[model samples]
Target chain A: MITKDELLQIIYKAVADFNSMQDVDEQLAQQANQVLFSRPGFTKEGLLDSMGLVNFLVTLDDWLDQQESAQSLHFDISDALENKEEALLTIDSLANYILLKNKKV
Target chain B: MSIKNSHILILSDTNQSNFSSYLSKYIKDAKVVTTPFNQLMQVLINPTHAVWQQHYALIIFWANPKSLFPDLEKTLIGKHEMLHVKNFFLRLIDKAERVLFTGFENYPNGFYSQFENISSHNRYALNMMLTSISMESPGVVSYLPGYYSPVVKGLHAVSEDLWYLSKTAWHRTVTDRMASFVADMWKQWHGLSVKLIITDLDDTLWGGIVGDDGWEQLRLGGHDAVGESFSDTQQQLLIWKKRGILLAIASKNDEETALQAIDRHPEMKLRKADFSTWRINWEDKALNIQSIITELNIGAQHTLFMDDNPVERYRVAQAFPDMIVPNLPANKLEVPAFLRSLSCIPATGVLTNEDMHRAELYVAEQQRKNSMTAFSGIDEWIQSLNTVVSIEKLSHQNLTRAAQLLNKTNQMNLRTRRLSEDALWNWSQTPGQAFYTAHVHDKFGDAGLTGLIGVSIHDDELFVEDFVLSCRVMGRGIEETLMNFIISLMTEWQLSNVKVACLLTPKNKPCRDFFSRYLLSDSHEWVFDSKARFVVSGIQCNVIDFN
Candidate 1:
């Protein structure tokens, strides 16, 4: 099961101008937490779970690719994800995997 | 920070501010050279010493770029310059793993217009040709549309859309069509199919069961609504048999009654000879399925089981779940659509000679299966085919098909390796690396690009870095031909040692028997002792040299 907070983090990474992880986390916490956001108990750990992360990463990937500016931000998260047995199991995992496989990591 | 950094060697006028800030932020290792674009020809003249030091992963040229083009006055000159740039681009692609051509002049249509006016159908055609060429040759191209403001620097990066507009429709249709075309070709190329379809012979093939209805009352074939529908459906199944997809009977009925029904019925499209296998016994569905899979030398996954009985469908689904057991349509009217849906996988692009002989080859395989009952030894079984091996060097066209086989093939594959379109070109364009893939053809038919081997030459030694064969042709001495062919090349090259390694994968156990004779062990062992052993092989074989 996925939580709202993880979904928010994925969206944040994809769209937000926030440069740091802390900024991303804050935006997620604020945007999430309400049951209206879909899926209750919106915790960070719930968001990072395998299925949750994959959905998050796919959304983030599409958002990043759509951005017209900021060619400098590297989307290299592959090496960290490659350690997993199934390379595409999670959102963060896939985002990282694509980055590394393309040598962006 | 590490991710953002790229070692870029830009040969643009440094005075330009367009992508400088963006490059600084995105790329960690930036070597912004002030040299003009034309000066790049001078820089690459002494590639080994001068350009080697830069160790640039990518190079960008930032300018009004139109300034370099003195005029489009002489259309021929512009064309010649484009050709020169294209050739130079190819050379760069061969040298570098990845290359991008961006920052054409800032005019709205300036970038695309140059290539568009140069006698091509559309921008996409030119772009796809270039992209496919780069893809085939181990490089890629990207364009950077100019940035209007500092805030949106590096905003208009060239990717698939800007590079080629026509690819969207071409890829969608091409990929879908290609999949089915490849599937059909695979059936023909292999020659032998699963021994039987083992379909239920009642409402499954026709509108009614013969056991329940009298022969005259039973519906099948030609005129009068449902009868014609049954005839059309039965003819479609016959099409499968003509392609060497064998039919089988697994009807739950008295043997005499079923035989009589098939023999006496006027509308029946399928005759007695159409079935090479049958299981019309009053046994459990599970037992019949197991027998069919065993007798066919096929897995349940390869078999397509059809039955009209809901209880039977459920039982078979539970018993042999791997078999393709499509549900009987709820409407019963949409049966043809349901059947056609199964033909979705493609069967085109590249086909081996064996593909044309597939149906006949399957018939031959049946003969072999029967002869096996009389013959005792493995040698006798193999000797019957008078098998031939044709090994060849990888050419420009077969590369895509060869790499595809390498990616999908398992069971007999030595190392379960997966390579992308880009990586295959990298191997081809990389200097001193001899990439060879083989196509196997015998008495049956041509199995196109069945084997692939990648050899890298370092110093004077030849190395078998990667080798794999399609599992479909495994058991036949195809492995022997591959290894011996490599050794022949090693001998011709005058290399003392031919280094080989078999990377282990669970499904690749068949390769263990292969390396036993050639590599001396089923484990990993590096054969090269020194750099002198790394030499290119000049050996040739008459077996697969068609050209």
Candidate 2:
């Protein structure tokens, strides 16, 4: 029952939460999708670095588990990254992959 | 109180942009100056440089041994260099108002292969040495723990890829956690601590209401899992009460029914006597909490109110924003975990004897208040209570309590200079310096050491540097008695006059007024006149000299 827009909003909120922890600017948070492949001030390098990627995936997993309708939907970051690298090329692609995974479940 | 204008200087071996960013959120106007990456040695060797001359409210020295000295374990010279580093910190301690050093975190095995054990041992030894140094130095030095081990599997706190990119040693997640930990340390250093906890009943204290399900049917303290969860919550609250945090109740329930359950329930860990006060009525919960605060004579900022309902929490928060109103978990089972996460209470450094008997002391205060109507006059009331003052010189036995009183007591503090344990010890060793603590006891109970006085003989005059008494012992003429004792000491030492230093603070008006009314004073010093007539006839005093 999770729509793509709802999943995108959840991902955005998770990103905002991470940004606020480091006191990053909200404008940089809004440009998360655009900066996925670029180096941001908050992160050491590209947003896909080991620490940044793990923090975002863990937050997303926790957020999904908290939702009543999506508790049973499992999305492992390692499995997704290994099987469908192109699906996580950008923030929008990651949301699409989550929506597709929820539909399959 | 606002740290918006404060400056903080950070000296770290790694790139500190992430740490700086995180600290900025808590202290908005904090101007942070970071040393060049891997330049801790250069900065420490010559701390008298122009860059170090700037006034900073706080200075943080955060450096990892691995990054600072890569071959520290392989060479003998590196060990000597480590000792030099410790000496550098001791030197830097005198330059800043407040300084904090983060202890080195250990690395996991197999990372350094053959050098793993040696590296770990060296890091451990270095950290222990630094901790001891910080303890012996003046009150300005504090140690902050920086180790982060993930409790959840598949989570890493150190990322090699991130370190290679920007030279940021720790992961962003670890940095975020450290930021919060450092902020708490800063708050405790400023003497901010929680004193009282006001809790609600019903779903908060038990699974079901006693009125709805009857005391027998209420799910609390039974073999059932839900019942045990509620019992665990009550047990935790009792432990906090035993450790000097006053507990109270502010629930909207029938007073008689609640009292019966609290008093007669076989499973309840807390009895009717456990609470200092309660307001189980139909009035607004905020109003009830206000009454409790007023009765306790504690600031709203030092009180915490907890309830299960989010609406009530919001109402209290709106009414008293200074007070802490934590949001409760939706499920009753999560109550214990939620309570454990409260970091508002600071960790007690050294537990004094008074701390262990605080609950009994508060009960004695109530008894004293009840007996006040029997006496005809103030002196008669004081005398009828049978009070005694025992004075002892500063020793290791009472050093911790002495430092705590100096830092936390505001109302009756003269010269209001907070001294760290090490600073107080150093002051006591100076020639002709005398420090004393007054232990007070009455018919009600022993109030413990509630008064402090520090005097030093300079030339023909005895200088009073610090004189403070706990406000709990105020209005009993204890201050005048202490002053009289100091004057007696001056007369015995053949000093010409007694000079007292008074610092003007908004909270210390009572202290200034005491000197202005009785003692002759000039612009900055109050000189005791030997010819002035004064009577100090209330309490019996005993003085013990340790020198």
- lDDT tens digits, residue span B195-225, model 1: 2466887777777766788566777765666
Lowest lDDT 10-residue stretch of candidate 2 chain B = B146-155
TM-score: which candidate is best?
A: 2
lDDT of 1 at B402: 68
lDDT, candidates in the order shown = 0.52, 0.73
Candidate 1, residues A17-78: lDDT per residue as tens digits? Answer: 32221123333322422111122343323334332233233335455565443233344323
Q: Candidate 2, residues A1-105: lDDT per residue as tens digits?
A: 767677777777777766666434422254436444333343433445444555566656667767776677777666655543555556777777777776787
Badly placed stretches (over 4 Å) of model 2 are A1-105, B1-11, B21-34, B44-62, B72-146, B149-166, B169-174, B458-460, B516-525, B531-537
Q: What is the DockQ of each candidate?
A: 0.04, 0.15
TM-score of each: 0.50, 0.74
| Whole-model lDDT, model 1 | 0.52
